[model samples]
Target: MAQWNPSEEYIENTRLYKWMQKLGYSEYDLFHQQSINDVEWFWRRVEKELGIPWLNHYDRVLDVEKGIQWPKWYVNGKLNAYELALGQWAKDPIMTQKEALIWEGEDGEVRRYTFSSLATEVNKVAAGLKKLDVKRGDVVALYMPMIPETIMALMAVSKIGAIFTPVFSGYGQEAIATRIAASRAKLVITVDSSQRKGKEIMLKDELDKALLNCPEVESVVVVRRTKTKAVQLKEKHIAWEELLSHQPCLEIEPMNSDEPLMLLYTSGTTGKPKGTVHTHSGFPIKAGFDAGICMDLKRQDTLFWYTDMGWMMGPFLVYGGWVNGATIMLYEGSPDFPNADRLWQLIDRYHISHLGISPTLIRSLMRHGDNWLTQKLSSLRVIASTGEPWNDDAWYWLFEKVGKEKIPIFNYTGGTEIAGGILGNVLVRPIKVSMFNAALPGMSAYVADCWGNQMENQVGELVLTKPWVGMTNGFWEQPKRYLKTYWSRWPNMWIHGDWAITDEDGYWKITGRSDDIINVAGKRVGPSEVETILASHHYVHEAGAIGIPDHRKGDALICFAVLQESIEMTNTVKETLLDFLSVKLGKSLRPNDIHFISDLPKTKNGKVMRRLIKNAYLHLKLGDISSIENPNVLDEIAQLKRPGQKNL
Candidate 1:
């Protein structure tokens, strides 16, 4: 039986259909092939079709003479990303339509802003930034919670051609200081205080603490979201309302196609982070392209992803939704807050069409029972997943329980460097359990063995053969580091460092991070493979797998898992889990350590810090864990007894 065959209504309504008709292509595969095969043709046609507004046309389609790493996009073109985002909606329809951006705070406060109102606020904030001496090419640090002001700050920074550097709201003083110092942020924007889980967090205090280490910061813009007066105001403090009231100027400036729009520092395990630079033409365009094509986002839809301002999805949501003239929703707290059904309530209230989440969240939410997902999600046309690869049990739960087996579970994998998705599920095809239907359009992706040979029906490294607009120009002032990180792995191909496999039917699935692969007694296994089996049990909520050094085998597998809130670890439960693991993963490869812990350390975004767990298990000093949501969770693993480690 077909799992999710596209109906005629679905097919005709897709943006893919409109493109096919316009380009004279009969099939989706052919269109995808052309998108990567002839970049000049695909991009030129897409730019015109999507109505991307440009102040000046490009002199050439692309120039790769320098190398693929420095490939130029929209060569010689002069345009601002915001203008392109509001392109055809520059005036009438957006204002007349009513819905645009909606915000929900953890305190039960709701606010709705139409396109006209949002545009005015954006212009006002941009004007305010200019008054603070934040001009073109200035680097500003955006450190705030997932408040509505954060969104405004992003546009304001982009409006004047300044490069915005974002830090996760959960970061401590050390994490915040390191990023500001690395980016050399000239101006900083933060809130006075904010509430999370009913506690007011003094962000101004945190900012002041971070500033003590970095003398480069000249001024600070504080938003009084919580109206806290716990700390005295410094001379550099500027109130959000006072500055924007004057409205210096709303004029948009033209930027070079290759100029840096943002300097995002991807989290590192040691030392300072490597800043990934994104251009005005590159990041926004790719987000719009993938959002419109792969996710099938329409202007009438509201897209919401559970994420933070520091993560790539934050900017992806703004640029992607706006570029396509769609409504975007912002939520300020945990999805499971207030109740387990918080995520469902947001969907029902906003009439969200495209719902995006992580498998990790789904795994946690599943313990709440399927009754929480009974909300009338008729408006939800697409359900998407990202971050980590989905375990089979979690994937099926999302498919059958939430989607009612009707909506497609669109899973895709990409990183900050790509700007958007590389491999993703599409609407025009049938999606299988725990698999993606295709590589996103304009991305030439394939699974290759260690020697770089393309593999069939086997697991290997995922590589991209062709470049797209979204690929980062290079790391900020670290061209050598950039080359070593991606380009050095394969001669010219972009090594994405994901272990992936393809089935005989051509469906693809990412097993795990290539570096996270575990080898037990010569036979290799992905952590996802073992973690899925453990999570499939009724008692387990979430699991993380790591490779450990062994005497006989090259490496051994060690698993850490969280038990369901209601279930306690007993001798019987342990024996049951051990027996199940032996059966599913084979006796030879069964984990030596299956420690049931209280929680797992994860980034602000929902990826488990497996490397941190490994370091903790081996009694190594845990490095800067400031970005982790639960930093102390590592102590659970640190207390475990390792073969050669002392009991602290």
Candidate 2:
């Protein structure tokens, strides 16, 4: 059954509706069909509709002579990415005085900046970067938290035609060093300290340790977010205030449409992190399209996505919100700090219209109950979800309780390489509980078997047949590796490394990553099928399910569950959960054992790293442990498998 149905008024007010009308199409399916079939016509119209500020318009919208894997977008166009997102807005008389950024620190500190003020800060920092001899094409690394300076520095770097790579603030020294060395970053931007859970973390101190292995990094620019402790600065370190004190230079460097804008790295399940390259026109334009048209983000809206700058959504938040002339909100601390009502309080206080969150967060917040949501979210019209797939119970809670059954939860899923969403819920269509109603226009997505034949209702690999605007230019300095990873699988299809299914009504659902699937006897099962059942239990907070080798059935399923606070580990609790799983997921697919753990390894974005759990359980090498939020948690799993305990 559909959870939310769009009324005629709702459909008419959507940006998608207006764009479709401009294109002379009355039906969304027809528009979407032509969008992927006649690629040039569709994207050209999108550019005109978006009013992309081009110094020189493109001769061709797309070129595929190099093959579908390496298609070029906005061929020969000239425009700065910053101009599309914020530069043009700052120059508009009507938008200049409108709030562009609103930041709230963990310590109850608030700061707001208008478009004009933000432009001035960016201009000064750009001039300061020039003074430091940071030339065009130089790579800069930002290791700061979600503060105003972080956004300012990113825009400043792009305005000067330099590539900026953001590192996650929660990372330790090794992870920081790995990215800096891989990108060969020239300048590193960081904070002296950042607050989290009522404690101050020394960011500069960690970066200093990382810099020891990154001699290529010539200078460090420090943003002093908190002065609770004295920070010792080295000779190459520059204060953020000093950069802002420089004379403002309003000049914007004109860049080719394909010039590198940001180099984002993703720590895959194994091996070194892959650097996904995004161009000046690619990331921002696609992000803008996804945010503005698909989600109906508007100029009067305040958009807040709970994310760290280290991830794709961090940059997505900045470009997506600003490109549409919307106000972006940033919060520095944990969403559940002090009390479970923290997120609810912020939503009411800020009057946020469009909000983005992960399903993991919603599951974590479920324990707090509905009492925390005391205020009516009158201003919130849309709630967007990404990061991981949603279980039915969590999805229902978010829709029925948090949104009061009046708002639609836009289930969004894409990756760093895709820039934004490949599959998302469009406002023109009726939304189901946890499925994407449509593939975002311009994405030729389908579920297919190993031989590239399309399938329905049966689980298969999710593949894209055509190139889209925001597809990553290539992996930084690793073209062959990129081709081998995505395009090498099929003739012309981009194998997205995910397993998905499509229903008869054309809605899509992602089961899990292709590699995360488990084979038991002859049946194939995604780990989420098991984890979802475990998550439904009252005592369980979160769970990681993995398949291990078994002589009897080829593979045996095992689980690690984190119970709620003060819940004792007992045989009855395990038997009850085992009985629950047996009822929910049949006896044939029940987990062989459930090991209670304190925490599961996760990324800063709240995605549980199931592969790492499996690696530790099987005594395999835990490859690329850089992105995990808790590296120590792996030791606990390793201890469980040590010499004396009972084995599965």
Which structure among the candidates has the greatest lDDT? Answer: 2
Q: Write the per-residue lDDT of candidate 2 for residues 314-363, one digit (tens) a residue.
A: 99999999888999999999898889989888899999999998876787
Location of the lowest summed lDDT over 10 successive residues in candidate 2 = 517-526
Model 1 over residues 1-648: C-alpha lDDT tens digits? 336778878877788776787788857788899889998888777677667778788888788988887899889998888776642354666343456789998888998877767777878888888888898999999989888888888877887899998887766565577678988899999998866766787778877878998898999998888774655668988888876887545578888898999987774322246688999898988888888866889776899987777778888888888888888999987787878898999999999998888776787799899877768888888988877666778888888888888898888778788998998877877788878888888889999998999997999999998888889989888888888878897778998877899888778888766676565533345676567668878989998888886644446678887999988888688778877776544454677768888988899998888889999988888889989999888887888877556666
Cα lDDT computed for each candidate against the true fold: 0.80, 0.87
List where candidate 2 sits over 4 angstroms from the true fold.
516-648
Query: Which residue pairs in model 1 clash with each other?
Result: none
For model 1 the local lDDT of residue 186 reads 95
- What is the C-alpha RMSD, rounded to one decimal, of candidate 1? 11.1
